[model samples]
Target: CDYELIKLRSVSLEALGENEPGASISRCNTLRCYPAKVPELIQNCCDYLEKNALQTVGLFRVGVSKKRLKELKDQVNLNRSLTFDVSTNAHDIAGLIKEFLRELPEPLLTRDLCSPFLNIPSS
Candidate 1:
């Protein structure tokens, strides 16, 4: 039998918190200025990484379990609150953040801004 394919759904950051009055201050195809300003998944992952994984070498280069990563992605796509406990692997969260960006319907850096970002000089 053939393996069943799973079609992952990309979360629309702009559409988040739209149902709540005054929740969104502004909306764009790429990003949203909602009450929180950033998507919950991105904020949580960054917070976790800053608090726990800042010193971990190769934070983003390291790989995590595919199954676990998929589970995490599913949780975020389902809009479930994520709790990263001490037992959670930082690599998984880092990978999740990368996956989230990669899966966006539009690139975080839109085509118009790509050149400007690419032109930024290195230190």
Candidate 2:
């Protein structure tokens, strides 16, 4: 069982690397610009959210169906133009954005920066 779990984890990580969201930012081939730093997946999600989800009450707090979220992830991972509709649930895209950030190989906040960030007092 342990061996099987490890094998599955390895396969999942390998697939994650091959996909867009979890890929190393520098090497990611999707919608990269010469000087712009944001990944296309993130940019697209933010754009959609800005346009549609700004007034949403529980924007990030709400949970979405796993099957729907998976479908959205698969679409984003394709690196193709956004195919999901504008009418699509905002929480679904928000969930996808959260998943993308979570899956990054390195934490968005690096270890060295974590201490400094944590030390800062709340405003």
Candidate 3:
């Protein structure tokens, strides 16, 4: 399996505006492993969706501008949820297509492998 693991950690530290010891507030994030073929499939799928399904797909469908999303986080409510929703939307779109390629009334084997992004022990 050609696997990749991308770990992202976000830490927020309260402003030490006055006489305060430095401390960090952090949330550790772990996303599930996915097949490595996903990004290309997604770009292709997005092309179709953007042309036809943008409105129906909602905010998560196409993706938000990173700049806008960041600004919203600093200035709006439901910011965190929006960020995650956008990510989830991208994953969901890719996942469903993968499933479709795997089986339907008929079945097709895309590859013989475990999840590509899985963390496996090495000898």
Judging by TM-score against the true structure, name the best candidate: 2
Candidate 2 segments exceeding 4 Å error: 1-27, 31-34, 121-123
Q: After superposition, how far is residue 122 of candidate 1 from its true place, in Å?
A: 7.0
lDDT value, residue 61 of candidate 1: 96
| Each model's total of backbone clashes | 0, 0, 1
Q: Say which prediction, candidate 1 or candidate 3, comes out ahead on TM-score.
A: 1
Compared with the true structure, all predictions reach lDDT values of 0.64, 0.60, 0.33
Give the lDDT of residue 47 in candidate 2: 88
**Candidate 3 per-residue lDDT over residues 6-94, each given as its tens digit:** 11111111121121243222221122112332233334456555655566644444454555433433422232222223334443443
All predictions: root-mean-square deviation over Cα?
6.5, 7.4, 16.3
Candidate 1 lDDT for residue 98: 80
Candidate 2, 1-123: lDDT as tens digits: 121112222222333345445544434443442234555556777888898889999988899888887777556545443565755888988887776666554566879799999999999
lDDT of 3 at 111: 39
Task: Tell me the TM-score of each prediction against the true structure.
Answer: 0.66, 0.68, 0.20
> For residues 1-123, could you state the per-residue lDDT of candidate 1 as single tens digits?
111101222334444545344333333222333476576557778989999989999899998898988777666546444677767899999998787676666786889899999999998
lDDT of 1 at 11: 37
Top model number, lDDT: 1
